[model samples]
Target chain A: MQDTVLIVGAGPAGLSAAAQVAGVGYKAVLVEKEDVLGGAPILSGYARLVPSGEWARDAIGRMVKRVEDDGNVTIHKGARVTQLNGEAGRFTAKLSNGKSVKAGAVVLATGFTHFDSVNKPEWGFGTFPDVVTTTQVEQMVTAGKIACPSDGRTPERVAILLCVGSRDRQIGREWCSKVCCTVSANLAMEIKELSPKTQVFIYYMDIRTFGLYEDRFYWKSQEEFRTKFVKARIAEVTAAPDGRLLLKGEDTLVKRPIVIPFDLVVHAVGMDPNMDNPEIAKVFGVGLEKHGFIERGEHYTNTCGTTRPGIYSCGAAYGPETIDDSISQGMAAGARAIADLHGLTRKAS
Target chain B: MAIHEKSLIEPERLLRHDNLVVDGVDVSGHWNTMITPRTITDYDDDFEAVIQRYPGAENVHRCWQCGSCTNSCTMYAQNVQFNPRYWIYAVRTGLKDEIIKDKDIIWQCVSCNKCTSICPKDVRPEGVMKALAHWLEDEGHMPKSPSRIFDEEFTEQIYARGRIEDSLVLLNFLKKTGQPLVPQWLRVFGVRLMQYLPVGLGMRFARNFFIPPRTRSWGRTGEVLRQYVREQKEATHG
Candidate 1:
């Protein structure tokens, strides 16, 4: 049998990649940093996904199951690739678990980290319990309830603030975190559905519910759910006298600087580079782009190629990506790795 | 539907029906004010190119809509409606009607040059403001603003004599725009200046105002420069 294909991170991208590699009559080894499989969807505890509306646990769980059920695939939970050395066709990866794997090609699916709300302290994320992130809100939704953590009281009004920790020149994060607009729109509708009495207001610099998401999330939230969309990025989130969150912002549409109160404030945090990117890049011998995501090579020519040959990267490792896109890219990266592996095996023989 | 740009939802565009009837059910208060849908058919596709024809507006096409110009504008600080960034967007996207809506205030730009200095794309927003103001006047959308008249007379003085006589600039400006020769503020300032001025300085001011000092040997240069300026104006306005 040919050598195994090493897949890193074991997220949506990594899992699908591993499954694809194994399906092609080659061995697949998955090295995950966390103890369990399923990347952000399982790790971050994501709720209903966009477009499909399937629970992340069920959707991404199926991907995990497929990879796990494949006997040709080997999974090392709670482990990392501490070292990687060699050329495109032949490479050796040393895992943190005191094991080594000789592989034909490496697939780095190391995904992104949730932009910590603490970086933008002005939004009152850490200081105030009511001011939570989009991920935290997703977790709350998964738990079948949306209540303020402080008193477990159902909020009368909620404010979903977009572009937090993103598109802010002050903090040096100028790139738009593509998903926040659609995610917040979806979250607004979910919040409205969970609590019929609750009034939801989405504050945004601009709405970028791209492509097919326009009718599904942004417009549907406005039409059916009655989610109030305001074209104003909240400048500050301060605690009111009675413990409600006060949002200070310029309502640019109405052309007035306004201060409004809300029960729960959701900061639609952006996607940052994976925290271990520097170390991963060093180990894998790949380059990162200006925005800190893995650098892609001759985009159209190389489907998922990294700086170094024989290594492919996909999903948030490239940039802010949706779960569906990450999966599709996973299959693509896997197909690429399989093609590379086939060439390497031919050379070895 | 909740548009971020304020101008898109002007009062005239928004229609509120006090008693709206769909099919005899009186669904008035149930539905909110509906924005009168406008399908803009008269898009001047070459609007950005037209704006670039004006002096200092060459970089209008390079705007990435970062809003640094509007954010740093001195006029914008005073009044948010005076948005250089928004006007640039309108010009780039060929929204001439949008630019026309704020005709009166477009000339209020004090030419502070703050927008030009802060513009990352080197859009030269101060120049675009002047260009828009001039475009408005050229298109007969607005009357020649007082500032335009002052700029013309002041520049004409320099072209005519190789130097501007401040009194002549002021006198000619007031005459062209139909204002009194000596306004109240100018009169008050004049009174104070004459009362407090040293004897020799006041005499020099009088001589300069009456004779209007011309450059030595400017005989041919002044005429050539004036002809060049006229040609430039014709080339640009066309």
Candidate 2:
């Protein structure tokens, strides 16, 4: 009998894993909680197909079609694996809306959730109409316009707050949330392109432009777009009478308080593990860290696999990751799961 | 096939059930290092102790080795092991010996207050790290480096003169720490020249260097601190 692999989530990681499993002949059943496949990336509307921004619609369309047409693969939309039982080689899953399935192995590509901007109320996410999140900006860009949420007018000036919840010890998230700097830089460029008249300002503690992501977008914004890169953490956001927002932050480099008024404020919120992963861990009989990511085994041998046998996880399920890293991790996890299933077959034989 | 075997093969029942036992226990002494008590001395002088203290650092006992603080640290991106989280965990569990091992790092903090700012449970990871450095220094575990000489000389100067004279402190630190005085000479000359700069050019910096650190208005902050130190010593050894 052909072994079956159940993949939870339909984001980049999930779709990538499903493609690998189907290629190797194990029946791949991909489940998604959302009505569509792409998850938050689709919601945010960023076309994060690697090698510097290709059309995500085309990429996702191809992957979705391939998974749908594959003889050994099944796609379940608006369905979630509510419960998981048993272990490697023979596992059972309970799906939402009262369906059940059995699988030889499980892959949890349940990705991360964006840290809520409202957690630090000082930034005035919901309190002020102009202060929006990176996700909101992505949606506006996807809709072919960059209009301020409050007035629906082209904002004359925009301020992007980097590390809103990320790298903030007060908010209890200290990690860099790696992708924020790149995403913020990219978004700043996107905003400048979308609305050329609007001056963009990125308020940051420090510009962490690491890897190939270094200096390219940052310099482009500063030199070409004339984006103001402020070395300061925003202290408070207060509303002005004329609907403009006032931002107060200490320019630590200069050691003075900088009060800037902006028409729009975009909070470059950080990423944290998916909200549901903790309950999922309980369902799967696996361990989760205190921060609530599925515990991985020795990172070398089991980079994408969990501490439990036969259960694998990849991408933002561990922490924040870019779309490229997520896809790569999905491929690695798929290969591992395939090897595991084949190993089981040999043992039985 | 038998019904029982069929039930075993059923996908829903086979995977979602967990029957493992996980009873919680105080697993503090599980580490081999905790098996024996390690004896060490506490803070050497009252002057050093005052600088080490931060209000509301007693919650250092609540760290659960979560590694969240370290992983979340912005500083961790630069260096993974320079973790306030682990240091806090060590301090919380009374793992003084382990914390003292990190004496060199305790002083390297940039004091951006980022760790304390982001703590989830208000663990004040930055404050705890400061407390750890203080505890280690109290225990005579401070690294005998240039920073130490700076601290010693800075303290000695304040005691000698009512207020700090930067020239004297720097000279003393260089003399004691064996740092070449040539660098000090260059810095002193540079500072003298800097003092003549235009308004708001180097005024703030010059003011900081020349003016001593402000103390309480009662003129008894130093005296009170000294008395407290003497009492602590008596209570410990009496």
> In every candidate, what fraction of the native interface contacts is reproduced?
0.00, 0.00
- Note the DockQ of each predicted structure: 0.01, 0.01
- Candidate 1 clashes between residue pairs 3 or more apart in a chain or in different chains: none
Error of 1 at A232 (Å): 0.9
Residue A259 displacement in candidate 2 (angstroms): 0.9
For model 2, the local distance difference test gives 0.74
The sequence of per-residue lDDT tens digits that candidate 2 reaches over residues A276-330 is 8878888887788766777886788776778798989888888878888888888
* Cα error of candidate 1 at position A176, Å: 1.6
lDDT of 1 by residue, A131-246 (tens): 99999999988998999988999998888999987898888778788999999999888887789888787888888999999878887786567566666777788988899888
The DockQ of predicted model 2 stands at 0.01
- Clashes (N, CA, C under 3 Å) per candidate: 0, 20
- TM-score of predicted chain B, candidate 2: 0.43
- Candidate 2 stretches with Cα past 4 Å from truth are A47-51, B1-238
